[model samples]
Target: MRRPVPVFLPALLLALTVLGIVTVRLVVYEFGGPTARRKAVTVPPVDGVRITSMTVYSGRLPPCPEPAFDDYGHHDDPVIRPLPTGGPGISATYELHNEDTEVFTYTIRFMFLAGTIQVGAFTDEVVRSVRPGATVRGTVRPETQDPYTCPVTRVKVAEVTKVPDSELPPPPERCPPSGLRLTSDHTAAMGLRVVGLHLQNCGTDDYTLDGYPLLELLDTDRSPVDGARITHGSGGVSGISLPGSGFDEPAHPLVLKPGESAVSELAWRTDTPIVPYLRVRTQPDAAPVTLTLRLDLGTTGTLAVSPWKLPP
Candidate 1:
């Protein structure tokens, strides 16, 4: 038995030497609960957006956005321990180097890989208001609930979708009892952008408006946009000449009763910073209502507003 052991030891040493034996170290990472052997998350060369920092939690498998891709088609792997309360987690800070000459909003998709094979996938995350020259910082945790046995070794950006920031939908709001609700309609053609602010009389009282809306543009952070020149008509705002845009309409006193509405126009050039919020007052002293207009207004430095008028 001793002779066999010696022979085996020599064979093992020979194999190790052929494998180019080097000092081996175990890589353990802090995952908030325990140290894990997960690899450091890596981001490949991606345009527009990059992951600046990432933290991955193992021992708890994350549920993929597409459950069809998640493990256990009713069959469990031998290594999957039933996680009573915890699962894997991942949080990443995304730095969008917009490098583009235009402002953009990005939607990123992520997947978890184990040894070159994707073990899970997650929902897409939308990061808004990424202006030119690296302006916005968004943290994405595209995670879900599940218990996976395979350690999340790497994270990969599966897909990325980008759109101009001016095109985003306004924040959703229900018609309130203030007898008024404001919304927007967006249109773009030949690089000209137009947003129609729709004011509806949702309550029983009559809401009256005259002339143009009192306007204030805001950045994504809700701060006033500096150097914004909001003109009263589209004449100097870039698209006032478009047919049926109503920027040329003359302002007159209008009354909106219940079930009635009026539309105001906002126009700007496509080359602009993201104006995500627009503070609107039907009158100079009326309560200000902020709409998520996504107006392409900052870069070009000019915005045009039309008075409340009947919709075309």
Candidate 2:
């Protein structure tokens, strides 16, 4: 009788242990929540605010498409001023701050509200792009006005955000008008001469060009002309002068959204006839772009802007 009691107690304990294991498994495996992992990423911060303080928002000239008037004695002319003020109307500026994991480019525009009538409000379609972790500034003003005034009344930021891809707007199909063929302290033409390459945002967005090309005239032998110089009269080449003079013109750096292009000009002259190729090198921040231009004596012509294709 004693041996049977001990056997029965051991059997009962084993059965109880098995039952407890089954109950715990059912509760944990079938009823518990899910367990999955995800990757993490960080993004920077950006801020834009309306500037009511008149002191900081002083007016200035908007950037020109091209400073080098490559095309001379051609039908190419700067976009004439339409308003009573003689230009795109107003001058405005905005402050932009970029905060993010990677470097970024921010584009901003201001719209003028004049008694509910918006007249001649323009954005920086070509010449301004901000970088990441930096503050960017932009201006909008009439090109042809004296004492250049800011025509807009109320200024609002058109866009203040970061773009993922580098490409914004593609270069426009129509070449941007290279401003005046001449850049002298004196003046003759009544209006502004639009210059530089224009790009379009065909890619459904906008982008910016680093800057205008630093044009160096190459001789027939494909070498940079050491002493060759360019000169222009008050009214441009239209009011000419001597030979072999080089005009040291600055290319206007600009930003273009989709359907936009950077426009610039090359107003230069040489004593010797220049049928040689015009070698173009873009700014440092931009990709190295080079192009061969065909020069025709006695004619100021427009140079078209295209992407630089490097060989593999």
Count of clashing residue pairs in every prediction: 5, 73
Candidate 1 residue 58 Cα shift, in angstroms, is 14
Clashes by residue pair, model 1: 60-87, 60-88, 61-88, 61-148, 273-299
How many backbone clashes are present in model 1?
5
Residue 241's lDDT within candidate 1 is 57
lDDT, candidate 1, 151-170, per-residue tens: 45456676565656443433
Residue 199 of model 2: what lDDT?
Answer: 25
**Candidate 2, residues 1-312: lDDT per residue as tens digits?**
111235585577578767863211111111122111111112222244343211111123232222234356445545532213322223444445555444444444445443344435344433234555666544554333332232333444543433322323223343222211111121123322212332233444445445344555455444666544333221244322224222223234455554443434343232235434444434444322223233433234322222311112
The residue-level lDDT of candidate 2 at 217 comes to 49
TM-score on alpha carbons, each prediction: 0.49, 0.26
Which sections of candidate 1 miss by over 4 Å?
1-173
How large is the C-alpha RMSD of every model relative to the true structure? 13.7, 27.8
C-alpha lDDT of residue 101 in model 1: 69
Computed on alpha carbons, the lDDT of every model, listed in order, comes to: 0.64, 0.35
